[model samples]
Target chain A: MKNLLTSRWFGLFIPLIAIGFGFFAGALIMLISGNNPVTGYVALVEGVFGDLYYFGETLQQMIPLIFSGIAVAFAFRTGLLNIGVEGQLIVGWFAAVIVGISIEAPLMIHLPLAILGGAIAGALWGFVPGLLKARLQVHEVIVTIMMNYIAMHVANALIRAYFQESGQRTAFIHDSASLASEFLAEITNFSRLHWGFFLAVLACVLMWFLLWKTKLGFELRSVGHNRQASAYAGMNVNTNIIMSMSISGGFAGVGGAMLGLGTFEYAEILSSFTDYGFDGIAVALLGASNAIGIFFSSFLFGGLQQGANNMQGQANVAPELADIIIALIIFFVASSYLIRWIYSRLQSKKEGK
Target chain B: MADILQILYTIVPAALIASTPLLLTALGGLFSERSGVVNIGLEGLMVMGAFSGIVGTLFFESIGFGFASPWMGMLAAIILGAVFSLFHAVASITLKADQIVSGVALNFLALGLSVFIVREVFDRGQTDAISARLFRIDVPFLSEIPVIGPMFFSRIYATTFLAFIVVAIVWYVIFKTPFGLRLRSVGEHPMAADTMGIKVTRMRYIGVMLSGALGGLGGAIFAITTAGNFSAGTIVGQGFMALAALIFGKWHPVGAMGAAVFFGFAQALSISAQQIPGLAEIPQVYMLILPYVLTILALAGFVGKAEPPKALNQTD
Candidate 1:
C-alpha cells in the first residue's frame, strides 16, 4: 500500500489535482467578481476548439511556447534555473529578422540562414551567463536577470536604429525566408497558422533523443545532480554547463525566430517584453521539465490563453484571468506537500497511512 | 570636478526618492533570508502592493478622506502584501515546497490578480491616476543649512527618512535583540535551533510576514512618490533590483540601504545625464542599463562576496 504512494502513476495524479484545483480556484475568483463561472468556462472551451480558426490560433501560440518550454526544460534538467529565456528569445527574434531582411538568397538557404542566425544569437546570450557561472562563480540567476533588461534595451535600440529611415517596424521578411502557410491558414479559416508548428514538434523529438539517448545529455544531467560528484567522476562540469546553456538557448532562439519569420514577419520595437519567455518557466514546471510534458503543458497553457481571449470578447471576463489560472496551477503544484499529506490521510482511512 | 559636484547635488533628491522603495524592500528581504526562508516573491508582493496602493487610494479619496487617503491606501497595501505573502510562506515553510517555484507563482499571481481586478473595477487594464499624492517636504531647520543641507536634506520625500529609520530599527532588531538572535539561529541551523526549543517554523513565518509588510510598504512608496499611478509597467524589475541590493549589501540592513541608494543613484544618472557635462555624451542605452550591468559585476565578486543563510532553500 505504501508502494502506491511512490509509484510513477501517483506522480501523474498530483499534477491532475493541481490542475483541477487551478480551475476550481479560477471559478471561485470568477464568482467573487460577479461573473458566472459556468459561462466563463464554457466560453473558454469554445474559444479553444469551437472552430478551426480558434484551434489554429491556439496552435500558433503554442509553437513559440513549445520552443521556449524546451529551452527552459533543457536548462532545468542541467540543474540550471534559466530566468533569462525571455532575453535570449528576444535577441533570437532580432537576429532572425535581421538575417531575413539582409542578403538576398535562395529560399532553401535564406530560411535556414535566418534560423541559424537566431539560434546563434540566442546561444551567445545564454553563453554569457553560463560562462560567468562557470568561471567567476557568480550566480546565474542574478546575471540572467540583469541580462534580460540589457537584452530589452539593446533590442529596442537596434530596432529604432535599423528603422531610422522612416518605418514603424522592419519590412516584412522576404518570401524566401517566410514561414507563413496560405494553405494551412485557409484550412483554419484564415487563422495565423504557420509552418512553425512542424519545427516545434520536431524540436521536441530532438530534445527527447538528445537527453535520453546521448552521452552529452548524461554528462549534463550528472553535473546537474552534483557538480562535485561529476567532477570526481572525471566529467568536465564546466563544459557541460556551458553546452547545456547554449543548447537551451538555441531552443529559445528558434522560438523567437517563429515570431519574426512566422507570426508578425517584421521586427517592431520591443518597448516591453512578451510573456512567452516568462510563461516558459510555468510550462517547464507544470510539464515536470520533460519534453513530452512540456509539449502537453504548453499546449494546455496556449489553449487557456486563446480561450481567455474568447472569454473576454464573449463573456466580458478579463483575459488576465488566464494568467491567474496559470499562477494558481503553479501554486497548487508548489504546495503538493499539502496534497500528498491529505492523500496519505485518505489512504490511511481506507487501509493504512 | 565642479560639474561632477553640481551633478551630484542636483540628483540627490531624485536619487533619494527612487531609493526609498528599494531600501525598504531589500531590508525586508534581509529579514526573510536571515530567518532561513528565501523570498523571491518579493517582486510579486511589491506588485500587489503597488496595485492595492493605487486602488486603496482611489477608494479612500472617493469616500472623502482628502489628504489622508494615500496613507490609508498605504495601510491597505501593507495588509494586502502581507496577506498575499502568506501563500509563499505557507508553501515554503509549512508545506516544504520549492521556494523559488513558489516565489515565481506568487509573482504571476500578483500581476495577474492585480491587472484582473483593475480591469474589473475600472473597465481597463490599469488604474486611474492618483490625485492626492504625498507631496515633498522641505525639512524645517535642516533646509536652512548651507550647500550640503540643501543638497542632501531639502525637498525630500518623507518616506526617504522613514526608510532610513526602518533600516536602523531592522539593524537593531537583527543584531541587538534576543528574538533576532533566535531568528538568525533558526535560519542558519534549524535543527540546532529546534533542539534549543526555539520555534523555528514560527520564526520563519514571522520573518516572511515582516518581508511582506515592508515589501508592500516599498511598493506603495514607489507608486505614491514617482509613478503617481499604477499600471503593469509601473513596478517592472524594481523588486529584482531590491533583491540584487540585498545580495550586493551582503544581507545587512545598513549595507542593503547603501546598495539600494547606489542603484537609485544610477537610475537618477540615467534621467539626469543630459545636464551632467561629460556624461551627456554617453548613450541613453548605457545610462539605462547601468544599474543592471553593475549588479552583474557586483555578483561576480567585483564588489565582494555575499554568503546567504546556511539553511536557505532546504526543504527538509
Candidate 2:
C-alpha cells in the first residue's frame, strides 16, 4: 500500500488535492466578496446532487467533454497538437445539423444518419491539418488555428443561409421522434440526460480499445513516441498523423451532434462557439488521457458546471466563479510536475521511515 | 481612373486598422519563435489585453485619460498575460511538457478567466463600449497629399504608428543587438547556447514574456480601434493569424510586418468588397472568410521553404 501510494499514482493524487485547494481558494474569494462560502458550497453540492434534473444536466454537459476529451487525448497520444478541435467541432456540428434538418427519415435512420454526418464532417476537418502536417511539413498548430477561423466563418455563414429561419435558429428536430431519449431521463422527470451519454461512454471505451488493442493503435503509439524509429520499423508515419487527426475530429463532431440533436435540439446561430471543444482539452489533460479517468474527470467538471449556477443563485456569487475555478484547476493540473516532485520527496522520506 | 482610385483609397485605410492588431502580435510572436519557443498563448494574451483596455477606457473617457488608461489596461493585461504564460513556460520549459498542450491549456485558462471576470465585474458577458474611441491622427504636412496622402498618412490611429515603430525597434533588437543574437541562438540550439553559458530556461522565459507584452499591446489596440469595446470576439483568431504571419514571415521582424500588412489588405478587401461594383454580388461571408482562406493557401504555397528556428521543438 505504501509503495502504491508513493508510485506515479501520486500524479493523480495531486490534482485531487489541487481541487481541494481550488475550492478552499474559491471559498475565500467568496468570503472576501461578503458571501458565505459554506452556503455557496452547500448550494453547489445540493444543486448537482440534490435532484434528478440537475443530475441530468450534468450528464448532458459531460457528453461533449467526453468526445472532445478523447479528441485531445488521441492527438496527445499521437505526438500532435490539435488546437483546432474548436474549428473541427464547429464544422462537424454544422454538417450534422444540416443533415438532421435537411433529410426526412424514420427515427432509427435519422438518428444514425445525423451522428454519421457529424463524424464524417469532423473527420474531414481534422484531415486538413493532418494532411498539412504529413505532406507539407507545416505545423499542425498553425493549420488547426487557421482552420478554426475558416470553420467558424463557414459555420456562421451556413447558419445564416440555410439552417436559420428568418434569422432565428432552424425549427426543432422532428419533435419526440428526432430527439435522443435516455432511460435515466424517463426514470426521473424530463431531464437533459439522453442516449448521448451512453454514446459518450461507448466512445471512451472504443478510444481505449483503439489505443491499446489494435495493430493500428500500436503503430500510432509507437510513431508518437518516435517518428523516425517508427518509420524505420515500416510504419506509415504520415498516414498515422492524418488518421489520428481525422479520428480525433470525428470524436469531437459526435460530441457536437449530441448538443444539436440530443440536448440543445435546435441549432441557434452563436456569435461564438459553445466552448465544449475547448473545455475538452482541459478534460483530456486532467483525465491523463485514460478512458476511465476521462469518465470520472468529465463528471467532476460537469458537476462544477452544474453547481456553478447553484453557487450563483443561492450564494449571490457570480456563476462565472465556477469557470475561474475550473481554469485554476487546469492550470495547477498542467503544472503537475512541480506537485509530483514535492510528492516524491515526501514519499521518499516516508519510505525511509 | 476615379473608380480605381476609390477602391485603392478605401482599401488603404481599412487595411491600416485591420493590420494593426496583426502587426503588433506578429512582432510579438517573432520574438518568441526566433528564440525557439512557439508562443501559442498569443490568443489568450490578446483577449486579456482587449478586456482590460476596454475596461480602462470605459471607466475613464477623457482623451488624455483614455490614452493613459489604455496603457494602464495594457499594464494589467501584461501582468495577467505574463502570469498566464508562466503556465506554458513551466509546462514546456521546466516540466518538459508538450508545448502544444501547454498552449492549448493557456488558451482555455485565458478564455475562462476572462469570461469569469467579465461576468463578475460587469454582470453581463461583455464590457460597455468605450465612449471616447481611439481618434484618427493625420500627419501634419503629409495629410495634404492627394489620394495617397489621406490614404496613407491621414485617417490612421496612433496605435498603427506605434505598430510600425515597434516593428522597427524589434528588428533592431533582434538583428543589431547582442542580446537578440543570444536570444536567437537559444531558440536555434538551447544545448549549444547553454554550453556557451546562456541560461536557456531564462531566455525562454524572456521570449515568452516579451511575446506576452506585445500580445497584450496588440489586444489593447484591437479593442480601442476596431471594436471600441471588449467582447469575446475582440481578439478572436487574430492571434492565430499572427502565428501564421510569424511562419509566413520566416521568423523575421520585417517579414512579419510585410506579412501582417498583406493580411491586413486581404481583410480590408473583404470588407470593401461590397463597395466594389463587380464584387457586390458576392456574399458578405465570402468576403469575411477571404483572409482566412487566403492564409491557408499562402501557408501552403507562397510561404515556400521558410524554415523555423532549428531548436523550435527542442526542450532540454
Candidate 3:
C-alpha cells in the first residue's frame, strides 16, 4: 500500500516539478529584466484567488481547457495524436453558437441541442483525419495541422458571409434561452462556469468508461499498443483508429460548444481559435491521460491561465510568460524520466529508514 | 520579343528569390533527419532568427554600405536560433520526451515569447524595420551572357549564391566524408554505432545545432529579402513549407534543393497567378492558401515513406 502510494504520487509530482522549474526559470528572466520575482508570483497567486469574482473567472477560463484536455487525453489513451482538436473545437463552437442563437425553443432542448450540434460538427472535422489515416495511411499529425488552417479559413469566410455584425461577433442569444439564467448569474456573479463544468466532468467519466470497461475499449487499446499484433489477432485496426479519433473529436467539439454557448454566448471571429486545442495537449500530458489526473491538471492549468492577467497587471511581466511556464510543464512531462529519477531516489531514502 | 524577354527575366529571379529560404531550411532538415532527429521546430527557429536578425541589423545600422551590419546580423541570428533550439534538444534528447510534443511546445514558446518580448521591450507589437538590408550583387564578368547569365549572375543577393554553395558542401559532407559516414551510421543504427565508438548523443547534438544554424540563415534571408522587417506573421507558414520540401525531396540534399525550387515556383506562381490574364478572376485567398493545400497533398503520399533514416524516428 505504501509502495503504491509513493508510486502513484510520483505521477503527480512530474507536473509539480515542472511548475517549480518553470517558475525558477521565469524568476531568472525577471531578474534579467530587473523585476522582483517574489512580487510577480504574489500577484499571480492573488490574481487567481484574490476575490470571489477572480475565483469564478478562473473556473470560467478552465471550462474549455478541461473539456479539450479530456478530449486530447482520451485520444492519447488510444494512441491517436488528435492535433486537430483546435479545428474540431472551432467547428463545434460555430455549430453550438449558431444553434444557440437560431433556436427559440425552451431552455432544456435548446441547450442540449446546441451541445449536440457542436459535438457532431467537431466529430465530422475529426473524421477527415481519421479516414485519411485509416484508409490512406496518412500521418494524423500532418492532416490535423492542415485541417487547422482549413477550419480557420472556412470558419472565417462563413462568419463573414453569413453572420457578420458591426463587430466580428454574432447577434446575442435570447436571454430567456441562454444556458445560464439571470437568476443563476446573479448568484454566481455571471461567471462563465455555468453547468459546463459538470458537462466536462461527465465527459471525463464517459471517456474513462469507454476506454476501460468496454470490449471496444479493449480492441482500441490493443490496437494502440501494437497494431500489427492486433491485426494478426483479427481486430479491425483501421475502424478502431477512425472510431477513436471520431469520439475524441466529438469530445473536443463539445468542449468548444461549452466555451461559446456557456460563456461567450456569441461566436466572435478570432484570428485564431483561442489556443484551447494546444492547451488541451498540455493538459492531457500533465494529466498523464487519466481521468482524475486530467481533473487536477485542468485546474492547475486553468489557475495559471486565470492568474496570467494578474501576473501581468502587477508584476510588470508580460502575460505571455504564463505560456512559457505552461510550455515548460509540458516539456518536463514529456521528459518524465527526470521526475522518475527523483521519485526513485526519494523512495530509496524512505525505504532505507 | 520584348514581352517574352521580360516574362523570362521576371519569372527566373522570382523563382530563385522565393526559393532561397526553402532551399536553406530544407537542407537544414536534411542534415538533422539524416542524422536521426525529426526536427519539426524549424518553423519556431526561423521565427526566432527572423526577430534576432531584424533587431541585430536595426541596432548595427549606419555601418558602411549596409554590408557589415547585415552580415553580422545574420551571424547573430544564427547563434540565437541555435541557442533557441537547445530547448528542443534538451527536452527530446536528454529527457527522452516525445519529439513531436517537444517540437510543438517549442513552437508555442517561440510564438508567445517573441510576441511578448517585442510588445513589452520594444513598446510595439513588432520590431523596427531594418535599415540595412542585403544588396543585390551582379557577377562582374558573368553578367554578359545572353540567356542564362542575367538569370544567374545579375540582380541576385549574396545569400542566394551562398545557399547554392551550401548545398554542394552539405552533399559532400554527407556522402564523401568520414564525419558524414559516422553521422549516418549513428542515424541508421544507434546501437551499432554506439558499439563502434561513434557517439550517438554527440552526433545528434551536432545534427540539431546544424539545423538551427541553417534555419536561422533561412530566416535571416526572409527578413532581408521579402519582409525587410520583423513583425508578427512575418513568417506565417514558411517553415512548414520547408518541412514539406524536405520530405518531398526524399530526405536528400540535392533532391531537397529541387523540391524547394519546385515549391518556390508554385508559391511564386500563386502570388502572380492573380496577375496573369486568365487567372486574375480567381480569389486571392485561394492563391495564398495554395502552398498549404499542396503540402497536404504531398504529405498524403505524393512521396511514399522511402524510409527516413532508420534512427530518425527512434530515441536513444
Report the C-alpha lDDT of model 1 over A1-353, residue by residue, as the tens digit.
57767998777787889999999999999999999999999999999999899999999999999999999889988899888899999999989999999869999999999999989999999999999889877777778878888988888877787643346577788999999999989999999989999999999999999888999989988888899999999999889988998998889999999999999898777767887888998898888888888889989999999999999989999999999999999988878888999998888897843
| Docking band of candidate 3 | medium
Interface RMSD of each: 1.2, 2.3, 1.9
| DockQ of each model vs. true complex | 0.77, 0.52, 0.56
Q: Write the per-residue lDDT of candidate 3 for residues A1-353, one digit (tens) a residue.
A: 35643576767767778878878877877787777889988988998888666778787777788778877877777788888899899989888888888888877788888899899999998888888789877778767877776777677767777887758988776553356545445655666567777788888788889989999988988888999999999999999988888888999899888877878787877775578998999998888888888888888888888887888878877777788788777787788877777767887898899
Candidate 1 lDDT, tens digit per residue, B1-316? 6666666667998898889999999988888999998888889989988988888999999999988999998899999888989998998999998888888888899999999988998898778898999988888888888777878787788889999999999999999999999999998999999999999999999999889999998999899888988888888888988988898888899889888998899889888888877789887788677778877877777877677788988887
State each model's TM-score restricted to chain B: 0.96, 0.92, 0.92
Q: TM per model?
A: 0.97, 0.93, 0.89
Over B1-316, each residue of candidate 3 has an lDDT whose tens digit, in order, gives 7665666576677878889988998888777788788887888888888888877887678455366788888888889888888888887887788888988788777776777777677766678777777777788888778777887788888888889999999999999998899889988998999999998888888888888889988998888778988876887767777887887777888888987888777766766765566667775556545555665666667645534687766666
Residue A268 shift from truth in candidate 1, angstroms: 2.8
B116: Cα error in model 2, Å: 3.0
Write candidate 2's Cα lDDT for B111-143 as tens digits.
Answer: 666776676677777887776766888889888
Q: Report clash pairs, candidate 2.
A: B35-B187
Question: Which 10-residue window of candidate 3 chain B scores lowest in summed lDDT?
Answer: B283-292
TM-score of candidate 1 versus the correct structure, residues matched by position: 0.97
Ranking, DockQ, top scorer first: 1, 3, 2
List where candidate 2 sits over 4 angstroms from the true fold. Answer: A1-8, A31-34, A175-177, A182-186, A348-353, B58-68, B75-84
